[model samples]
Target: MKSNILTIMKKELARFFGDKRLVLTTLVIPGLMIYLIYSLMGSGMMSAFAPSEDQIYNVLVTSPSEEFVAAADQLKLEITEADIGDIDSIKQKLRNGEIDLYVVFPEDFDQSIASIRVGEAPDEPLELEMYYSSTEVNSSAAADIVFSYLDGLEESLSNLFNINSGSAQYDVATDEDATGMLFSMLIPMLLIMFLFSGCMAVAPESIAGEKERGTIAALLVTPLKRGDLAIGKILALSIIALLSGASSFVGTLLSLPKLMGGDMVELAGIDAGVYGVTEYLTLLVVMLTTVLVIVAIISIISAYSNSVKEATTYITPLMIVVMLVGLTSMFGNGAPTNPVLYLIPIYNSVQCMNGVFSFSGSLINTVITSVANIAYTAILVVVLKKMFDSEKIMFSK
Candidate 1:
């Protein structure tokens, strides 16, 4: 029994790995593409978050006071005074990239501060409104700098009045919380994508390509049981998909520091060592079962198609659904507490991974998801076996 399955698996593996072009496109190219794409995205994010060193910021002020003007000059900002009525035009200029930011000081702004300094409170609090285009890099940087300057001004006024605002409070988030946030937000979605891409790369060729080339008819005539052939094909495709997934996984881990703004110490505010042995084990279990499910789905789709192109076309909708399901982690707080939801296949795997990463994992749900996935794959294998036995499916024109 084992010999037949092994023979079939070996045949599939040899057929895949023996071809240099297939190996390159399936294994090597995916990792390389992910690294390049993610690195470029990270670089773009970094550039967007900061302005160039030589960039000069343009500023417009309304009813500027002597102290405010001094502050602007100290910061080396180019200041222009516009009428309050020109606020709309200034905003339009900001949107058009003609200016970086605009600041508006309330009427009697200096008098309000004077009252406060003389130990008399004003009837209303003094207010300043700064407007800037967040979509523009220079505008965002200028806004941050101006906000810092305002904070300093506020601190100076507080010191002049001897006002005590109490001690500073630091962030209370622990390493675990940060790690959970990062993992829950990133890993589940990425895992799903990688698993699907891996399976998509190979499953079509294993099933649909063989059908298209009429090689499946040759295999069907052999002494191998139809069930054995189905299992062997699935098992072989799963292994290859797992390797492809692993390659993509490694690429993501290596480029994560670059992806998270080039800071390895902090990812979504979490440091390394957030995940331990238990977390890794949980991830392994979820990933393995998830791969099986993905492979089964792809294999079924490929078996139904007459050619690799048709197989891909059939699987595209499934890929979109998987991607959409993976995105739930981004918006959800964590895994759902309901155990019934754990039986929902791909969605369950995603939520379970999210739960495990966030420290909210339920062992019961994990077990259920794993078992359910295997059970579902078994049903799919039965369907595939039937498809294998059908002459119309195996040798379709």
Candidate 2:
């Protein structure tokens, strides 16, 4: 039995390595994708830091206070006066890349404030609308700057009215540890995204490519059990997946310092010692889980695909979903709750990763979650072998 398995493993590895494209599939393509995603993200953040004059922010003022007018002028913005124009026009312009912002001042502007009696000069809050252009990298940031200035205007107008904005009703209760909230979101995302993307470069092509070349049928006759064949393929993919995870792990770590740009928050909770212990242990578990899930999914996807092209097309949506989940996690969103969460496959691994990063979650949760991921992997192996055993999959178009 051992020799049979070894023979299957050796043959699978030989097939993959025999292709000069293996290095590119297993590492190069994944590395490039990682670089592209991280580069775009890092550049976005860097743009926020670097001042540029070409950032010509357009503003539409429905009604502007003297001070609001002055603020726009000082910023050298092209301020256009429009009242009750089609909101659609503004949106259309935004879509066509015409304007960066829309600022509206209510008619009661000063009257509402004076009537409120506290910060009364005008009751109306100057509403600044920013429409972001998906194509423009800085459209969102430009909107942020516009809104920030408008918010300040609101505060300043109150001060000028001699109205105290402070309400004496105090709701203050301190003394809680909230340091770990970040881990609950960001770590899970990274774990999910890296694995999913890495799989894209290998899984579809590995199985479907062989089938396309009529190579799988030849291998099926080589005295290897269908189960071992499935495992051997999964094992090869797992090694490559582990490498991708490790590379991404190192890349993200290296980029954090740059991404944060000397921020204390980046410096505060993380270090080699901390990662080497808790984070590393958790990351390893997360990675193992990710590989299993990805391999299973890929095997299923590849089995149904008669060609690599069809497989890629079928799996692209899955890639997008994985990316969206990962992106959500990057913003600190995914977290684990019940034992059922641990049983939820890919999402559970991310939740555990987040818990590990925060250091507030229990070890029991981690262990249970890890076991669940491995359990999922085992089940997938059975399903994959069933595919291998089927004559329909072997010969079907």
Candidate 3:
């Protein structure tokens, strides 16, 4: 019995090691994929959070103090003296992301601090006002630096001065901008993954499963044009995938605020209702085109495969590519501007979605992406039609 068990174990081991593809997929590919993905994610997160070396934070100071200037210099802030009369214009710049920060100081700011440090307490703490747009990254970063320096200074001086003290909101960013920023970073990546999953679920079954069951051969013998058959399969698969993707998209959108934490949502005041019908309609167009592309690509791969399991195995690499492309939205400021980039299939969809969610996407780019995706799908359909007419592929044992 021991010798028989040993022989069985040897046979099993030999079979597992003999199939290079199985070994690669089950053992080698997973580790390599994890390493590559984590490396990319680490790099992406670093680039997203790390400030650039040459970044110059533009700041406007009113009634500037020597100590304040020194702090600004230390923080590498580029300061310009502004008049209180021009404060409204300066605020407009902050909201528009033209300037990083606007700091208002008391006329005798340094003198006030000196007097306060000598144990002279006033009826009210001296206040320093900082105005910035939270939606603008540079402005937010600048405000954080100033706040940190002031916090230390306040501690040393026994809280002699306070920063932006009160119920008054100093962040100049609009509610719409805040909503856009939150949605853009998360929605595009999620949308692509859902759409891809939808395609993966149906495409392999429709094409490769049919082939496995020998139904594809019978269907090929029918009077239906090969091109029509390909198009019909693609459209049917796309509709199914679209329904699946839309359901998930709606669920994700509805759940986002809750996912972001209820108290934080209430505090940040991010309203999902900020998006109008125009944005929704634009997103619908993007989703429809993206579904078509995903379905077409998957259908072709499924048709090329001889069985459902084989198709899924073949599609895994493409799934990884889709995930990598989806990650682009998390790293960039917005979509790429080049018209040519809108021609690449999966990438264009991700960028277009990114742009639309951010409210920074151009109409021309969206149009370009839609047209390019449709064109690619048509080409893929032609290729699929040719594959359908191939006897060697369809009738393969």
Candidate 4:
């Protein structure tokens, strides 16, 4: 029995080693995919959150303290004194991610601290208001640095001053902007992945499975034009994939708020209703064009393959590319402003979605992305049609 088992294992090893594609799919692709995924994610996260070494944080202070000025200099923070009348404008700058930190010190803060150090206890603790946007990375980092120094100072001075203490909200990010930022970062990547998965499910079966079963031969013999057949199949597959993706998209939107917050009270203002029909329509357009491009690409791969399993194996690399493209949504400070970047397939869809969800989507960019995707899909459709016409590819073993 042991000899027989060894003989069988040797036969299996011989078969496995003989099939280069099988070996590649089974071993090489998975390791490569994992490495690329992790590398892309690490790079993306670092680029998104990591501050530059030469970066000097811009800080706006209302009532400047001499000691705090010294501390700011040491911290590499550029301090600009502003009048109380400029608070609203300064906060607007923060919201726009222009400046990093806004520090509002109590009038005569030094005097107040000096009196406290002289054994004079005030009626109430002086509050230092630090206004920063949670959505802005620099603002958040600066807030941390400034707050740490103030925290140490407070401890030394016996809690003479409070930092952002009250029922008032100091983070100037509105509920809508906060919600948009979160959604834009996550939804684009997820949406593309879902669309790709949808295409993967049906494309292989429709083309490769039919070819494997010899049913596609019968269709080829029919009076239908190859271009028409290609168009029909692609359109049908795109619609089906869109439906599949839509289901996941809707479900994600519905459950996202709950995933974000634990309770209803915390999730009160975090509703998807912040997006109106225009935004939804914009998302729908992006998804529609994106689905067409995905379907066309998958169908071509499927046509080139002889079996469902082989088609799936062949498509794995493309799937990885799609995933990496989806990850571009997390790379920079919002979507890329370059109109030419919209000409690239898959990436354009992600950026368009990012813009719509983030409420900063340009109409020109959306138009460019849609047009480019449509053009790509058209070219892919032509290639697919040619593949359908080629007896060699369609009837491949």
* TM-score (all chains, Cα) for each model: 0.83, 0.63, 0.62, 0.61
Runs off by more than 4 Å, candidate 2: 15-21, 32-180, 264-276, 324-334
Model 3 lDDT tens row, 1-397: 2443344334434544577774464445443554455456555654565567678899988898888787776788999998787778888999998899999998878988888889886678888899998877788889998899888888988855678878887998888888778778888988898889878877887789889999878777776678877777777677767766765666565555545545567677688888889888988898899899899999899998999999999999999999999999888787788989888888888999889878889999999999998898999989999999998788787
Q: What is the lDDT of candidate 3?
A: 0.80
lDDT of 3 at 62: 88
Q: Across residues 143-177, which tens digit of lDDT does each residue of candidate 4 receive?
A: 99999998887788786566787989777777778
- In TM-score terms, which candidate is top? 1
Q: What would you estimate as the lDDT of candidate 4?
A: 0.80
Alpha-carbon RMSD, each predicted model:
3.8, 8.3, 15.8, 15.6
Better of 1 and 4 by lDDT: 1
What does the lDDT come to for candidate 1? 0.86
Q: Runs in model 3 with CA error above 4 Å?
A: 1-159
Backbone clash count for every predicted candidate, in the order shown: 0, 10, 0, 0
Clashing pairs in 4: none
TM-score for model 3?
Answer: 0.62
lDDT by residue for model 1 over 272-353, one digit each (tens)?
A: 4778898789889888988888898899889989999999999999899999999998876878899999999999999999
TM-score order of candidates, top first: 1, 2, 3, 4
Top lDDT prediction, candidate number: 1
